[model samples]
Target: MKARTRTNLWFQLALVLTLGTLMAWGPAVPVQAQDVVVKVGNIIPLSGPSASVGLQGKQAREMAVEEINAAGGIQSLGGAKLVMLYADSESKPEKGVAEAERLINTEKVHVLTGCWNSAVTYPVTAVAERYGIPFIVPVSVADKITEQGFKNVFRIAAKDSWWTRDQFAFLKDLQEEFGTKVSKLAFVYENGDWGKGFAEQWKKLAAEQGYEVVLDEPYPSTATDLSPVVQKIRRARPDVLMLVSNAADAILLTNTLAEYKVNLKAVITSGGGHADPSFLKAAGENARYLFDIVEWETDINKPGAQEANAKYKAKYGQNLTGEAVDAYLAMYVLADALERAGSLDPAKIREALAATNYRSGPGMIVGYDAVEFDETGQNEHASLVMVQINDLGQGLERITVWPKGARRAGYTPVFPMPAR
Candidate 1:
């Protein structure tokens, strides 16, 4: 045979061998379309006032799902990938309920999560319970959410009552640490289930601590101008101001407080708005010396936390907030349950979630050690860390400063925030 013909024959033999090897490898593991898809319905305030945090939660979930899928997905289900289907609650309880109904009946999502507003989550829980769908709440801290006697609802964050309890404990510690007395207390919050819930506990705790409640103010979260509320806080003459606000209002309240020069020993804020990624930038100097309670902060001592935050910041153009962290971890928690359940049945998934004691993983970057759920479907290990917003010579950042042990090393908390 000619040289060209011999060369052609050799190439054909090699091509045949390659094709045989590929066939023996079992069809190249199939395409994504052939893999099982686990649909997770996420209901959140994608519009209106809570949009910023809602967007953060969405981004976090997407990142986690992408990672989970990239890491071979759910092995037991033939490498099933999680598919997130989102519905906007618009911060309305009715809208949340309606969206929950649509996501369940129409989208046929196996698991449900979110509706960040506690009011929305409160009612959405019933809908999930009625449908026998497991609803994993990432950061909605309403006690009523887990207290509703529903087997399908689980919360991954400390409840509002727990938050309030910690707030007062921190206050006691604050007074002892600095040798400063905090006599008068003020409660300012959004007039919603979440804010009202926190305020109710604050009142009881204040009374128990023998601290006089100087002001109890609840304002609309949609209020464009918070000067009136700031004026009330200024006039209340409280030593410390406790706040529970969403993102927009959190910024508005902080700016207004600074603009009006509200004098107070310190400002303690719940994590929602105060923990927002954009809060420091939007509030600027006004957010300084503010103490906020959260489940996770950028300065946490956990392993992999800084790396995760760095990766997230590179992807999302902002550091991970507590809300973002919870949402991110919720995806991992759900992925864990799905892995163990080994089935798509909601009942099996629910059983797996109820028994979860997730200890270590990329998602375990939270301050807590584990993600164990109590009988009430609350993560017993879920706890809050108090972070002070200050410039540690690096612009403004949240520095963990509570529980004493977890406090950032070599950083002294500024109490009785200096006057502007």
Candidate 2:
């Protein structure tokens, strides 16, 4: 053989050996690549009146997805990664319905969450139930949403009556501790389902607790002027003001109260406007001493609650809403179900979720001892906390006050709120 022919033979032998080695070792594929994708959809007010609450929820859900994906995705289902989708409900019931249908039909999401406002939640939930999609509500407090007996719908937050029950206990404790009895209450709530649902229960509960309902005023959720209603409350001379309005109305009512220099023993603001960041900003100094019953709080002593909040604030430039915290927890709840399911089938995931007993890891981050769904698809173990806005050294902090489980409460409740 000539030298060129010998060289060609050597090159061909090297190529053969390299091919054999490549075949034996396999291709250079990543060791951690996910084999499947679990798609979930979130429907909240990304725009319009209630966007403040919705925006926080949106960030929280996104953060949860990011955290879950970072933790090597789901262990079962061949390391399937979670994919998030969003639909803006615009804070309207009809819009919520439209967006939910779009997400289900177009986006092909496996499970759904949100539609924050109770008015929106009611209609949106109906749509999800109609389509056989599992819908987990993180924020809406309307009891009838779950009372309608839909298995596909689930709620992680306390029901409307739960807040009222907690309120009664708080009042009882306040009277015992401070001798400032709230015998008379003036109700000012919007006309929506949340406002109406809470007010209806509040009226019955307040009366049974010996609280005289002085003036039950129902205003439009979009009402910009609450002066007339404040005038009614002031004249009624109620010991406590019961507020069940949205963020905009909450801001308006608080500002109007301050402007009129109305004084009361205390003000009980249901979560809507009372806990909203916009209510804090818009109500200004008037927000101080305003007692709010909330589902979640940053000051909770849960292991990772504050750290999770810090990460949230770093990105969002504000504190997270109680609803937002719940939304974050919702993702983990779904992820837990997906992991146990070990399959992408919606029915299997629903079954796994129904059997969820998530007490650790990302699922219990909301401070609930255990997250187990009841027959009605509501988290029976879910509860709420009471937070009061106080002038802390840093600024206005909504410190948890009523619930003894709260990690930090600055002082005894401030009885007979000072005049503006």
Candidate 3:
């Protein structure tokens, strides 16, 4: 009887102490709201020859993510916050595939984006498909990337083929308005999938436009010495030069062109090195008056684009490039999908993406007429504008000169590049 009483007394004392502690603590504080985090993974060449393109894209998306979070995140999922994950592929296709796999399997990101350059995006997007992750392409424009008919892969920029027809129009305008007499046209590009498309399209267009193909050249992307190629260009004496190159090759060839003083009636380029800020900076005064077809230009006078330019300049201390503008829009596309999905299910996100008609929202910042994806997962209404670098010193400022509807006042395309 005495042992039982001692155990009962200890229990009574424990209960009394618990009550006293509760009384001292007062009313309980309500549970703090938990943040629902959505993870997005991106793989790009951050340290290779194309690193500038990747880094520029990275900064643009970071700016968008910050804006999204500041605006209270995704309201559909109780203020779900987005987290960004990035991996560098060093501009290698195999490395891009490996990094994309890591992002999907290890990091378990809900959506995947990036893998610039068509060479890298092809394999990396294939991985995203096998894992059933939604992938939005911001840079790579290889037609085959979307032609594979993968539902999970969607592209927000104009395809390579889509821009070719516009090029014909641009050329016509050049001849009629700028008095550039076109007879012989030389086509040159790096030997890769993207360059192949550029070359093929230029060949077809030149034939249709009644211009002789004087010189067609395909050089290695890693060709550091382009003096021989420049010599060939000098010998060909084409009336026009159509160069489709990435940034590094563009710099190399530009140097060669300057060295040999290879002058043509006009020079036109499709993206890559010719349309990039790094190329302009490296080429310096030589980059002036070159016609470059671009996805987006800082000087495009549009509602959302003008506003974005101001904000982008304030944030990055520089104007937004085509790659950066596309990337900025890409993040918004993912966020819009997440908000509409209302759940982390990849299938639902894909469905949301298919049904997307983000015309009036953040998707408009890139001035894409429509954000809706077609059956082939390509944006049906991606905006395209051409710009010419006007300033030739340390910094390059490319002003929109083509697509008269998008050009700003006081911006004129300098045609028939002045002889060096």
Best by TM-score: 2
List TM-score per model, in order.
Answer: 0.71, 0.72, 0.70
By lDDT, rank the candidates, best first.
Answer: 1, 3, 2
> Model 2: what TM-score?
0.72
Question: In angstroms, how far off is 219's CA in candidate 2?
Answer: 9.3
Model 3 misses residue 283 by how many Å?
8.0
Q: How many backbone clashes does candidate 3 have?
A: 2
Which segments of candidate 1 are over 4 A away from where they belong? 1-34, 47-49, 92-95, 173-200, 210-290, 294-296, 403-406, 414-420
Q: Which pairs of residues collide in model 3?
A: 246-273, 247-273
Q: Output the TM-score of candidate 3.
A: 0.70
Q: What lDDT tens digits, residue by residue, belong to model 1 across residues 1-420?
A: 699999999999999999899878753555454557999999999999999999999999999999999998898888999999999999999999999999999999999999789989999999999999999999997678898789999899877778888888888999999999999999999999889988988998888879999999999999999998888888889999999999999999999999998889999999888888899999999999999997777888776788989999999899898789999999999999999998878999999999998988989777667898998899998878888999978899889888675677788899888877
lDDT of 1 at 103: 95
lDDT tens string, model 3, 56-128?
8899889899989889888787888889999998999999999888999999898889977889999987898
Candidate models: Cα lDDT each: 0.90, 0.82, 0.83
Which model is ahead, 1 or 2, in terms of TM-score? 2
